[model samples]
Target: MTKPPPTTRPVITPSRVVAGVCLVLPFVAMLWVGSYARVTPALLGIPFFYWYQMAWVIVSAGLTSTAYLLVRREERARKGDGR
Candidate 1:
């Protein structure tokens, strides 16, 4: 017997894209070792390597929160609860 055809998938939206970027930025920043693997820029005497990661800690939180809020709003609107 033949297999069934696939169903339609959800289309990507701006909100979802923003959320994806929010989640990916932190990983990219941390993984790009050559970018921050240095001691030239120091934060209160902390090496660039260490300080860069620390800054990302805060940046990640903000990005994550923004993404959460954006997607959440979209979901709520879809559910007819955009108040």
Candidate 2:
């Protein structure tokens, strides 16, 4: 019985760390920004605090996407997909 080839997997990598950080940043930001203080602004008759959270919706999406992409790329590289 012949043993199968061992898989080339990374125990840790830079991309993985970056991706993980990216994923956590928005949540931290949301918590800090939301409960830290209060702001009053009249943008289209909307309050500053309200708009701040709303704006983070987009920012969070972007950060999550970036994290996803970085992790994916690292995974691909680890798998040796023609890198």
Candidate 3:
């Protein structure tokens, strides 16, 4: 009897692309320091540099969660489990 071929490669889909973008956005925003490296436009006396990073802490959480959910949903669908 012949053995079945192994499924070694991952499939790339639109949902996966969106999830990847969602996950990468936070890193890009934080790493590009020049964009947020400033002291003007203070918020409640807080410097822009400080406030921008702090705000990203919250935004990053939301974006990461979204990416996780998207991947999880795609996996579940692939497994034929609607729930």
Candidate that scores best on lDDT:
3
Q: Per-residue lDDT tens digits of candidate 3, residues 1-83?
A: 99998666888999899999998999999999999999999999999999999999999899889989999989989889642
Q: Please state the error at residue 47 of candidate 3 in Å.
A: 0.3
- Mind giving the per-residue lDDT tens digits that candidate 2 earns over 1-83? 99998786656778878888888987897878656357666469887788878888999899899989998877788679663
lDDT against the true structure, each candidate = 0.89, 0.80, 0.92
* Model 2 / residue 81 / CA error / Å: 6.7
Candidate 1: RMSD over Cα atoms? 4.7
lDDT computed for candidate 3: 0.92
* Residue 12, candidate 3: alpha-carbon lDDT: 97
Mind giving the per-residue lDDT tens digits that candidate 1 earns over 8-71? 6785899999899999999998998999999977888998888888889999999999999999
Clashes of 1: 0
**Model 2, poorest ten-residue lDDT window?**
33-42
